[model samples]
Target: MRSVALDLGVHEISFCEVAGGAVVLRRTVRSLDSLEDLLGPSSSPARVAIEACREAWAVHDTLRNWGHDVLVVDTTRARQLGIGQHGRKNDRLDAEALAHAVERGGIPLAHVLSPHRRAIRHQLAVRRALVETRAQYVTTVRGILRACGHKLARCTTEGFLTVLSAAALPAETRQLVGPLVTALEMLTPQIALADAALEQLCTHEPVIVRLTTAPGVGLVIAAAFVSVVDEAKRFHHAHQLASYLGLVPSEDTSGGRNKQRLGAITKQGNAYLRVLLTQAAHTILRHKSGDDPLRQWANAIDERRGRHVAVVALARRLSGVLWAMWRDGTVYDAQSAAVASAKGLRLQAQSIEQQAQSMKEASVKARRRQRSIDKGLGATRATARSRPVSTSRRASMH
Candidate 1:
């Protein structure tokens, strides 16, 4: 069997083919149309490996369609393969390294998202960009007003325009901030349209609907989770899902001691998903009633470790909880969460009680052993006094 590696570029692709024990083919192809010619034939499928990039999914899909086993390697992991360690870093070297990696099974493959999920992910990205642009414009407008000893009142997006229009400002200040306000006004409608489209998309997704049943998870957050996760079955447990979202604590241990130093999250996976979950956590903590089990759990954590820590913890827990709900095909239930909490508490209490009882029994045994030892010593002394000194001692005394 032969393996091929492609160093894909915007306008060109460098490929290397390995057969038996050496490089059989190494060349650069200018267009995707010529890729088939390089591959020889469609009947003889070859293992193809490529570093994951913006165009990776497209290339992978194309090659797969042509009967090639395409493996998209993670970009970061591919860089660590020591391809350019000697300074002669070029497309040919990279292609050869990738081909060798594929042959030796050293490449870490990336998850290939389905078309629908990829589309949703892209739409969410677009929405995030629009929202961020709008925020930037708003901040610029505020900064300009503040520089002139004026402060705009806190208001909604639509209200912001009204406030700008009615502000009693000098002509120069107005002119200076006019373009920013106009940009903001233009961004507002685009953001609203994106929100509306997201809402429509989420409305049609049953998984998103189930996710929304979780407190603090509205349409946007739910949709983001569904799109980012794609397949719930990918994670065997909630912990894995949470870890994938970079919500879990990082572990750093050595010298036979397994210590997990609580620090910032790993932030390894989709950053957008992490942000959405954190925002959802904030909403859950702020608006949810204390009586709610999830809220109570968060409140308990807040009491122990400040509010900010509680929010992050809640976010991490929320990721796991939502994943569990999705995996089990069940809706989030407040009562069930409460029951689980109570059961955990009961088990903890039982464990403490059993430990205390064992300690007490051990203490009693120690006391009995000490008493027996003391009694034996006293009996020995009595016998020694009653029988008098030994014959050798008596003779020495005489």
Candidate 2:
């Protein structure tokens, strides 16, 4: 049996091959594309195995395309079964160990991500990184401005630089801020171009289209969700997706009893996806209309417990909703959600009604103010007319 493994590193990818449990080939692949030359044409089908890494999916896809039966193993289990415990850790041992582990079935196998999916996800990952980097720079610039007692307006619709540049900043502060403004100016065009690329990607992606069906999930959130999960079928239920996203409550159970504590999210898996989901949840809470069952549940919890807890709870629910929609291809329906989750739905409607009432009152007050202003203006005009402008003396005399 000819087997191969790649010792994945940030800067370098080392390759090792084993035949009949003996080291026969060793080479470092500079990039994923270089793997083609290493695997020679064998008379029979070859069994290849490699530890799951950031680059594992791409590499796995490439190997599979070359007509090899590739096994992607969980790195943790592979570590437990082989050379990880040994004093010396190197490419040679890791490759052999992966081969042995695969032959023995000691490690759980990883799914080979399709090239199409990998390409789509790669685009999403790049977009995500750029967005986060842009946010970091914006925060840094804002901090500098705030430190000097100059406030920047919060407006993401316009580019960060546009907002900052339009500010009436001190000349000295502007001098210090010029480079940051210029950097943001540069990033803005790149971010727009990236967003257009992502949108084009979304046009053909069914999963993204399904994810975006939920009320508040935009293209960015949908892309992030799809990139992270890859396959919703992998998870059985919404709770599974929630747990995967670290949206579920952490449990403390002992002595045959389980205790629930209110703490920050465990934040265990796919932090980026969780943030996107939570942000989407917050948007729904703020802007969504109608009798949403999930919204009702959140408001009730907020009233009984607190706003923070409610928001988290809602976020968890949102995860399940996303999963259900993705898994079943069902569109969102208020009546259906309310029927299924009556208590949560009722509470959401109540909250919306309350907001509606406040708006209604504000509208009434504005109308009354307008009427009063109109009445006062009319009286002033009548008085001016009654106070008679002096007639021209020549006309009166004629």
- The TM-scores, one per candidate, come to 0.79, 0.73
Expressed as tens digits, the lDDT of each residue in 22-130 for candidate 1 is: 8988889786667787664554788999888889888888887887889898875766765786777888889998888878876788888888777777888888998
List where candidate 1 sits over 4 angstroms from the true fold.
Answer: 40-43, 79-90, 255-262, 339-398
Where model 2 places Cα greater than 4 Å from the true spot, the runs are: 1-3, 10-38, 42-44, 76-80, 86-89, 157-163, 251-265, 339-398
* Candidate 1 residue pairs in clash (backbone atoms < 3 Å): none
Candidate 1, residue 259: Cα displacement in angstroms equals 4.7
Residue pairs in collision within model 2: 293-345, 296-347, 296-348
lDDT per residue (tens digit) for residues 1-398 in model 2: 55566677777677776666667777776676676566544334567777778777776766776777778776545657576655767776676677666566556775555556666677877867766777888888889999999888778733466577689988999999778666665555565556666667766776665565566776678777776777878976667777767877776665666555445667877777777877877887898774677687677898998877888787787777766656665544455455554122221232455445534543453355345445434544555566655679547877
The window of 10 residues in a row where model 1 has the poorest summed lDDT is: 341-350
The candidate that wins on TM-score is 1
Candidate 1 residue-wise lDDT at 332: 63
lDDT of each: 0.75, 0.67
